[model samples]
Target: MSTSSTGVLVLLGAPLGNPEDASPRVASELVRADVIAAEDTRRLQRLLRELGVSTSAAITSYFEGNESGRTEPLIEQLYDGKRVAVITDGGMPSVSDPGYRLVRAAIDAGFTVTAAPGASAVTTALALSGLPCDRFCFEGFAPRKDGERRRLFASLAEERRTMVFFESPRRVADVLRAMAAAFGGERSAALCRELTKTHEEIRRGGLGELAAGAESDPPRGEITLVVEGWGGPDPEDATPEALAAAVARLEAAGTDRKAAMKEVASRFGVPRREVYDSLIDRD
Candidate 1:
């Protein structure tokens, strides 16, 4: 539990939204460490105030903008055998945040690294998603640009394991729309917003419905989206009728007819002409 004995770096997982979620060991490290590297010093200060814990540790800002520059100096402190604790504003350090570089540097310099585990939004959202959690993958954040986002979802169209993603409130609708286009409108998904917070909302439905809901009332606060993966047989194994049906479903969900055909073609491992022909014949 003591960090001052050697070149030890403690990575503490702060509460996602609730201050009470912080563990007792994390509070101890926050107060007793020689140096504290925080993603947002103001937020860290707020957390300390909420916990009513005081620390004599030297606090330094270590975020995306300065994490690289701060890594060397923090590593030096660790090399000097000073206890250094890394903490993010929410969730675990280095988890879609700024602790990877410092942790890697400390390990390279033979400093021991440890963690004070606490609440995680990823697992929390996953459990609340009500999707199959037996096998799942966390996609840190979806791309911002529409093209990039569509391509990303297109690439994962065949993924069988449940997929989790962190998205901004601004792009929630766009992400959902792209997901519907690539994975079909009937694909199950859950949108978890402001998790563990006062206004937490979990909207469960097909991608199309969720996208429309987000468009109508853009959600605020942190957003985590959980999507059901391709649990059935491979797309290539699907019948011609099935491929046509997929395209029709996407088109019905607001996807362009041609775009839906293209996505279905790519997903089903069939030629674009074949998909188009099937849809045309059915029509």
Candidate 2:
């Protein structure tokens, strides 16, 4: 397509960590674009410096906070026959960044959108995770609230494909705890931190074990968690009724009945009320 043609978006992938990881096509597009929409202009400049590529394109900020307001100006530039290239601080734009809105706007405006794919933590971690990769789902980040996080993990308890998630260091332990409770304490998983960086670390173990490890020392840097799919429930495990009886036993052992029922409900993947009703039905 001609450089001056309206409605064209060039999505370029920024370097994940190693500057050499930037693709040749991405460099070419960055140099040739008429307008560059970058998540961080300083980071973009640094990337260009690292790659030895010079760009004189009019650069504008496009990030999470202002993406909505900036989409119009970007679309206007595209409509005015300027080739607009969008890049995030690292990784491909819009995968977990703020470029989706502008891309969608451009598409609705009949623009041609294309990408120069490069490094991604999602696939990078998945490949390094030692988990099944044939089929997988990327859940970027779980809800922060405990109740919401629990519900979110609970809904995915039966997912068959390997699951990947992005989590911050601060909440990694809590997230692991919730995953352990929802997916089973023994579910195998990999926690990949700081992929492609010098201090990169990968911890592989059961969810409960990982949670305990995180408790000892919270992880640092970006993290990608890869969890194995459900292994099917144990056939010989206690039934719901039997589980209620066990809860009663725990209560008789001095545990609060309500709390015991809640724990049983979580372990058995049922509602607390259901476990309570089971206990009543047994009585």
Candidate 3:
């Protein structure tokens, strides 16, 4: 169905913390859209008020809860040749937010999709993180469950690229602790909270120090964490003997021998067989 574009699907970026960061293009799209899908209808109304623009667009909620249910209907609107605009609570519509499904459906149905980029927490936190940003990865949100969270951190322990993660205020400390456990207590990191807001704060330290500090002074507001990658030698760089010695340390710290070896293997991006061979040589 490569017919002429029936309608346009515009994804607008909302301000992260500062309303002034909202772009003119975003405002224009909001005012011009025939239909607007918002993560929160009330928040969208507030944004419209701040922008001082009245929109006649049909507004509907399209957050994670209703995203699946809303996609088809929104796609139908696009097929009807109606201009549809999407906005999230903050930042872009589909980055750790809803709207991806609708975007995909719109394109599948031959509608033209476009974006009006604006303020983003991912880049904003990375810039303020004081860590290497030239190469980095954004991990949408830290997993809330203990085992899953640790597994996630363990999987990325040896990642050479700096890592960014969005976390809840309540779980920030726990996440830092988990990272320390998986990536080593001395791994450097930065915690950014309430970015661009009046109460904005940036705390930088080793994972352990950050975890400890969070105990006495609980963090508040939206949280973004930036973690330095393993900048030292890669695991493969270690001599087999060195691998055995490292495994020994983990065991001494109460990690099971098998578990320790597995962790070492993951951190080094090496096969477990190599780590096992080192342990065999030690024996």
Candidate 4:
């Protein structure tokens, strides 16, 4: 068949691990694309081989380093009425990958942009996590520095939706510990490692337990963490004394009485005004 004359760019989702996860539409598009842009040309070739889809389209490398330089050329091809297909090393393109820039360029150039959506680690982990999926947020990866990581967690401290994050196995424990400290040790969470692979395993427990275990074992391979959202305060367990003590510590650390009361109230799941009144009465 002749190459498509419609200047459309397709973002194809590659298999995360299981080759069969490739959708039939992805396979057909692979066979029909006029040009293929891949994050890793070799990996894309291997995936195509596994799917038994042969393509005559010229393959070009478009990864993090050269994505900017390659976007215009790809856009030019798209402008010339060619079916340009973009695929990442694994999963869908532009998702923590290098396809977003090209997609944005194509859209700006008045070219049609679409995707043959398929397997995604974000949704896959959320589904198997057994956590509340009704509403959730994806935090791709935590910041590397400790201060930045802490600040990031602080910003999300009040996020109600179940939180999903991707982390390197090397730093999984560290991130978990930070989460435990920021979100509380008792927060329900699940740590998923090597998902969909032969060594797939999902460990569910309190953030404290998970953080300790992750540190002890040091998981390997891709890691996806699913953390339960704040379910209000643990009034049944947190005593008034405990809340007051927490407020004192915050106040000692230079936090204003009002802010300290708010933090303590949130930390202990009590009424902010009551905590404030208690502080005032004690003073």
Candidate 5:
């Protein structure tokens, strides 16, 4: 697809670890590229070698730091109708990675943009998480700062869909600890590390349990976290035990017993008397 005015901008998904996992289409397209914009030139070289495909395409760096400056040149190639392929260190481009700019630029410039999809740590972790993957949201990476990360977790506390995030191994423990506080200790989650690599490990447990384990061992390598979403405390699931726990949680947050009972009653459509009985039973 190399020509003068109908240049196509292709987003290629690189293998997560095992190069043999790459699809045949990706290999063929790499050979067809007139310009290959890679997040890391060295990784690109290794991938090319492993795939055993030779390319005469002009290779250039396209990463977070140089995206703005590098995009126009790549767009120029596309404008010239040259087949341009964008590939990151791994996974599909334009994700939490740096290919979004080029994709947007190409679309804005009226160039056709497409993809040869492959492995993704997000979906991979979700599938392995054993959580409800029917509907989920990818949160990318949580903020590094404690306050910011906690705030982000709190905001997602009520989200009903499953959530995914990428995190650094160094901060996984802290993030899990914060998640337990914001999302509750019993919230189910999975910590997928070094995915698609030889040392790939997946740790599945409640947020509290994982946080405790991480503190002692501190996992290594790339980390992707899949967290169970908030299912919400609805009236239908309001068993006496559930109601009491909910009220106690509210009271612990400084709500008075009477008000907490009242709120729980209103929320669950249960009698204030039942809520009171549950609290009394706790005592």
Candidate 6:
């Protein structure tokens, strides 16, 4: 185990699908950690077996079900000068995974925080999707409920940057259909399935075409979707009221106020300061 002073919170990114894609540093971090916060303990075990590594670190379950409740004890571990490592089943923790609360808590508690970088479905798909990677946003997983999902889709309708989304095999077609309705069928997009593994596939087409194809032949793997941005005129024109309104929509959908404002700014192609000013004008 690595020497510990004030302790550290290591947010380790496990492989998305192929464990071999994991960085060399992952094995070393696995060894150095005093406590490992695994999103799926069984999955972590499989990963360890794949990597030919072993650790005596205490393993703890830290998935969505108990993320909030589990934060405090993890913080206490940090207080005790423990090298806490968080490894999700795939990708980086906190990007549509459990680890944000612990990270924020560690920062608030004045403990050092770091990450062992690894392959990400988000970037990997974006790179291979033939979409505009210069500006893009990860939308995480779309809402399961159609109403909320449609609302989210509508809220992002004006988003001009390339967009990426994660979806389950069961819901991939459903979300594609919803996107067809909200973003229109003609919107260009790519469906990247089983990325970085055997049987990996990247199907590119318009939203409508993809929706039809997915319905006819449902995808059967972890899916990451990359979509082209709006081709029409800028939605907000960076107006103060409109900027505030856009941020409000995202906040109403459970996004933090600051993050909502930042997203609004990115979508509208305006300075973040303008989004903040818009909020002030709203009051």
Q: What is the lDDT of candidate 5?
A: 0.88
The CA lDDT of each predicted structure is: 0.87, 0.86, 0.87, 0.85, 0.88, 0.90
Cα lDDT tens digits for candidate 1, 1-283 = 2445577999999998889999999999998899999989999999999999999999999999988888999988877778899999799998898999998888888888899999888899999999999999999998887767766786677688999999999888888999998888889999998888889899999999999999998999999999999965575566778878777666555679889888888777788988878877788
Task: Provide the lDDT at 202 for model 4.
Answer: 93
Query: What C-alpha root-mean-square deviation, in Å, does candidate 4 show against the real structure?
Result: 3.8
Q: Write the per-residue lDDT of candidate 2 for residues 85-173, one digit (tens) a residue.
A: 99997888998887999888988999999999999999998999898999999999999888778767766775778999999999999
Candidate 6 residue 281 Cα shift, in angstroms, is 32
**TM-score to native of every candidate shown:** 0.84, 0.84, 0.86, 0.85, 0.84, 0.81
Between candidates 1 and 4, the one scoring higher on lDDT is 1
Candidate 5 deviant stretches above 4 angstroms? 234-283
Q: Which of 2 and 4 is the better model by TM-score?
A: 4
Clashing pairs in 5: none
Give the lowest summed-lDDT range of ten residues in model 4.
245-254
Model 6, range 29-100, lDDT digits (tens) per residue? 998899999999999999999999999999999999999999999999888889999999899998988999
Alpha-carbon runs more than 4 Å astray in model 2: 241-283
Query: In terms of lDDT, which candidate is strongest?
Result: 6
Question: Model 1 residue 148 lDDT?
Answer: 70
Model 1 has a clash total of 0
Worst 10 residues of 3 by lDDT: 1-10
Candidate 3 lDDT by residue in tens digits, 13-63: 999878999999999989889999999999999999999999989999999
What C-alpha lDDT, on a 0 to 100 scale, does residue 139 get in candidate 6? 96
Which residue window of length 10 is worst by lDDT in model 5?
246-255
Of 5 and 6, the candidate ranking higher by TM-score: 5
